[model samples]
Target: MIQSTDEGLMRLALREAAKGLGRTSPNPAVGAVLAKNGIILATGYHQKAGQPHAEIEVLKALSDYPSAKGSSLYVTLEPCSTYGRTPPCTLAIRDAGISRVIVGSIDPNPKHQGKGLAELRRDGIQVTTGVLDKECTRLNAGFNKWIISGRPWVIAKAAQSLDGRLTRPIGESSRLSNSHSIRMVHRLRATVDAILIGAETVRKDDPELTVRYGPTDHQPLRVVVTKTGMLPIDARVFVGEQDTIIYKDRSWSDVLDDLGRRSVTRLLVEGGGQILGQLFDNYLIDELWFFLTPRLVGGDKPTIGGVGVQELAGAPRLVDVRYLRLKDDLLIKGDLQWPKNPSRAF
Candidate 1:
């Protein structure tokens, strides 16, 4: 029973929810709206973990508005039926006396799978789903991957010079790509669950790894994988309210378990080659997003690690490839398909 205007507003809410992307790690980006008599009462987007979710935020913004009892509630994801850091959103919807519920997507987590819909139906609310399936799923892909696969979707990112070098030379400060591409990197950061880097990249680049586009309301979890856990405690990435996790000499299964326990479902690996190599060697990479600049730096620096002769001899193969043109750069994306218990390719 979605009207044209209702669908348009739902799109707006989805975009609003996307704004919460880089910030609401360990929590899904969600948006909600309260509507009655074809009039919008309130709207909200989930801002961060431990804060009021989208539904709760919108209800609070309504603030005892007398006519909310018969309003319809529209949300980007199924209202969560379980209590975690906050109260169950299903309970909030029921308490509001909403006459109808429309959800963009369902929660893929087994614990809450279909439970939210069941709860709403049991409470005599009319519930409809799949209003904007594709956008909603895209927004919560990280959450779905973590819930269904026990590991976050891996996103490999890199910035190289015109000649495909990460840097001019070791320990040298040189620009690798243009400002537009760098801004796109920030946009990518604004949408992922977390940003990961190797200890060497942290020590050498000293990146802050915070989202620099739009608002600064929330930051993604900053993660570092180190063999010796040698990252400096005083690094700038540690100064923010963003949660940080360090994986040290742990098996891939152990790392996935830890991230699952912490509710991280999507992870971005931004590296200095060596870290990328290790992930590839372990057959842990799921997706690759490569930005190929038009210029070239014909230096001795490596492009991407784990692509050498020994590594490629038995490495995982690319199952899918897509091309995107961004100004002068070409974005090459691939899906990695690793064999069962594949040997260490590197």
Candidate 2:
């Protein structure tokens, strides 16, 4: 498909919208740009929930919206039509006399949905949908998942040695990936609502699980899954952050409900073998991000405590595998296609 120059600009606007990842809970991150005759005028993005929408921010930035009556507006998501905390974005577009609007994707909120686009048509405005749609949809995947499934989209992340081992010998907490990859993991932590690890992992690694990389507006909630509820009070995970949760044994459905109640739309699961086995056994994992390192630990060690499939044919398969080389480590990210179930958490 051929993309126009404006589409490229809209794509950039969408990227600008993603800056508010962990901060924008209960609201999708949106980016907008106002342009006239292929020249950009103003640009803005939704920073957090209850704040002004991207369109409002852009219009506020411009001194005179009436002067740019023939200008085009590019937004990552559909402008809202409802009276949220602020006024409807549809009304603002009409008042500004914007001749054209290019939307990256339709908003998933049932209250508005396509109503914003419909309002634009009523006002004799030219509107376009699906401009760089795939990328835009991906940018707000967490929001969509929460709206549709009522649960956070879980990503099970792990680093495996060349021989399929997850770690080094016992009592030795050596680093698996390089320093660059460690920073990348911190970046991933910044985007999610919470990070999960087994009690064993916390006791073994004593990881702080805080953002030590680039600038991030919000830090994810640190979570520990425990069976005995004997987590150390002085553990590194508990030293600084008070926003930590220690979850006990519960049904997979209830786990999903608990996360939903916490407004954790995006969850990253960093686990040891036993914890990974439990999630996989219940078919609760939504995505997988496994890193393959160059060093090989040629021993009896295994990557994860075998996710009890019972049969070889029933072993989980992660398709659409992609490999990105970070230094010598190969990061393989893929989506797991589990079968349909009563609860969409799987």
Candidate 3:
């Protein structure tokens, strides 16, 4: 049995956890709330990797150490029992004199999975698990994927007309998304570890691909995958101050493998049809974000190119579909139904 109060507190914890999404790589964003007799005492969230976790943040935020005694703690993710970059959170929770713990999701890492709860129970503290489990799990999908598969979570995004045309037949660069959508794209870029594009996009668009709409501490690594080693010498990508990497004459798998090794937990792929085609062909895409405008551009240029599905059964489908209106444009985002390649899951 679960209480509405518990659900509400867990939801707040989840909201707090999301604040650290872009900043916490190689670590899941977690939030915590301390409450006594249905009254909230303190709230905190994890800020970055190798820093104090959510449990520590909440405990330290308390005005008095004795205030947390016999209070219930609600957390989006389980407390860690082992030390890595910081001290074990379970020990801290016990030391704080917390009487009960309500958790949203268990630790995804095998080494710490369920161990935290076991240690707390051994100390005679009451523990409740799986409060808003689905939401908690989805919040850290990128971290979970990176932890389990040793690869980044791939997000394929594009802006096309209603008729599915990326640009004019001449392949000239044009703005299909509105000002609001462009801002949204910039915000999305801030949350990812890297931005990837095909060679053709570099030659045609010559995009700088920096986060300009809002404030970001660091620019994501710019990546370009090219079959041939030829590219414009003065492309903006090359001239930009941000770190850039060119994968000339390399397979998509090789590029992803190297990026994974570099600890890129979330990768955004902005495309020029051919690059998107390669991703789709390789079944490398985990999520899709398409901005569809009201106007239709009837042309031979499709949003995605490459040998597409020959039969209806072979076509890919999206799950957990979401549609949002960004000004006049429609943003369609969803996860792919099929599992990504286990070898190169980025």
Candidate 4:
């Protein structure tokens, strides 16, 4: 059973873990807390990619104090059992002498799936799971999706004026959404692994694509999808070779292979409409997060995606729908429910 104090500490850990977003690329944001004798001892959150994990940092923070031999540990995700950029977190937890472990969610990756829990139990540590399970899963949805699926989770976002136009007529500069909504967009950027846009968006907006607010520790990878690879060399997103990925009409297998090699787990697609249509047409998208404002712009500019289709007679279907009201805006989130046979076209 989890005590109220335990739940409170876990909430603090989750909030701390959220701060590591945008910086902890290729690593799941994790939070850990140690409590002994009804008193909290140490807390830590994963900060960046290729660095020590949350468990390791917490253990280190408590090094000079009393040992954790009889303490309880609360973690956002199951401790890792496989070694990657850092050592397996299970081994570190054992070394800390923690008597009991409470995990929020299990790691879905096959390599270290149940091994971490099994190892802790074998070493005589009492382990409990599913504390705030849904919340933990929601926080790490991107990492979970990547571990289960081959591709990244897709979040599609757009902002438009009261007239529903992303930009003014004749390509004039205009503010699509207010400052509050724009701030929320930046917050979304802080949580995802990557932000993607089409070549046309790059040519027109030249977005910096970096986390500009809150903690500046991490930034998402900026990606552009172009069939002919016509993106400008000096675009703000393309600061160097490492910061950008240009998706061309290459072999599908090759593209997947490259993405695997790069360890790209989650991908957020911010669109100029045509790009969204292309991804949907190719059946490459896994999930969709849509933010629809209450205002409507009846113009010739664009509506989400510009690929003018006469009808949705043969389009993919949404499997689920969720709605959230943010101030005056309506966020309609939907998940694509592909047919039983994935290869079959709608």
Candidate 3 vs 4: which has more lDDT: 3
Sort the predicted structures by lDDT, highest score first. Answer: 3, 2, 1, 4
Full-model lDDT for every candidate: 0.78, 0.83, 0.87, 0.73
Please report the TM-score between candidate 1 and the true structure.
0.79
lDDT, residue 208, candidate 3: 93
Model 1 lowest lDDT segment of ten? 337-346
Off by over 4 Å in 1: 1-6, 162-164, 190-193, 212-214, 227-248, 299-302, 307-346
Residues 296-345, candidate 2, lDDT per residue (tens digit)? 87666466675476676656678777788899988888778765544434
Whose TM-score is higher: candidate 3's or candidate 4's? 3
Residue-by-residue lDDT tens digits, candidate 4, 1-346: 6766767777877887777755675677888888887688888989888899998888888856457878988898889888799998888888878899888877777887778999999989999888887777767766776666555566667776555455545566655555666677788787776787878888898888887886545577777777887878888887744477777766534554466456666667788777766566556666666565656767666535535334566455765677766677666666676544455232
> lDDT per residue, candidate 3, 1-346, as tens digits?
5777999999999999988876788788899999999999999999989999999999989988899999999999999999899999999999999999999998879989999999999999899999999999988888888888778889999999999878754565558889888998998898788999988888878899889888777578999887777888889988767889999888776887788888888899999888888788778888899999988878677888878766667667899899999889999999887643354343
Stretch of 10 with least lDDT, candidate 4:
337-346
Q: Once model 1 is optimally superposed onto the true structure by TM-score, how far is the C-alpha of residue 58 displaced, in angstroms?
A: 1.9
Given candidate 2, what's the lDDT at residue 144?
86
Models, CA RMSD each: 4.3, 2.4, 2.2, 3.7
The per-residue C-alpha lDDT of model 3 at residue 2 equals: 72
